[model samples]
Target: MIGSGIGAPEKYRKVVVEKLGYVTGLQLSLRENLFDAAQNFDDLAKVSSELRLLASCLIKFAKDLRLLSSGPEAGFPYRE
Candidate 1:
């Protein structure tokens, strides 16, 4: 998606891939602790809320970029 959608260079793609791996590891760690009854539910909720905000921003940025690049001879000439 990053490559096709944003015309991301190889270096940028590598950075994105590394970040995604880090996020996946974090999610796995969170999942492992999610069932602990002693954990603070409010703090978990706040973390979830922040993740949602991050997702929203990423989606909006991708959508906006796609829109800006749409139409021939108007923006980026993304090859299909």
Candidate 2:
């Protein structure tokens, strides 16, 4: 009865919100990890390459999620 208007399924809206939260967390974690990697780059010289690549991948994923979450009125508009 709460969401008795527009079409889109409530479950789908919940899924999108959940995904946004997850992506936010991932972005924060990736930022922290990237910082740590930079700080210890000298100590972990040989493994820096892998760490950099991993950080790059995480950043890309976060960016993609951010784009997906953009324009509430346009993409997957959900009512609370």
Candidate 3:
């Protein structure tokens, strides 16, 4: 749905790619933080919450990107 809908419009396709890149960068940063937090278990709770938030955001970003990439001829793997 998204691929056909957004692909038909170049602007929407560009926006989706930009958004995906932004979220991917954030996920990388969050992964680095997890590594840093490993040495300071005292703040485990906060670190865990941050990790979860990042993961959720990353998942959403990926799903959206996938949707945007799906061609109208192809069946959608997700619904929004």
Candidates' TM-scores?
Answer: 0.43, 0.34, 0.39
Q: Estimate, for each residue in 1-80, the C-alpha lDDT of model 1 and write its tens digit.
A: 21142354657656665787797774321123323534546866999999999999999999999898787877667689
Q: For each candidate in the order shown, give its overall lDDT on alpha carbons.
A: 0.63, 0.61, 0.61
Ranking by TM-score: 1, 3, 2
Tens-place lDDT per residue, model 3, 1-80, is: 11234224656555665777787774222223434455556666789999999999999999999888887567475466
lDDT for 31 in candidate 3 is 26
Model 1 Cα shift for residue 28 (angstroms) = 14
Q: What digit string (tens of lDDT, one per residue) describes model 2 on residues 20-76?
A: 679777432122243455555565575888899999999999989877876766655
- Whichever of 1 and 2 has more lDDT, that candidate is 1
- lDDT, model 1, position 65: 94
Runs of candidate 1 with Cα error greater than 4 angstroms are: 1-39, 73-80
The C-alpha stretches of model 2 lying farther than 4 A from their native spots are: 1-44, 74-80
Query: Per-residue lDDT for 27 in model 2?
Result: 31
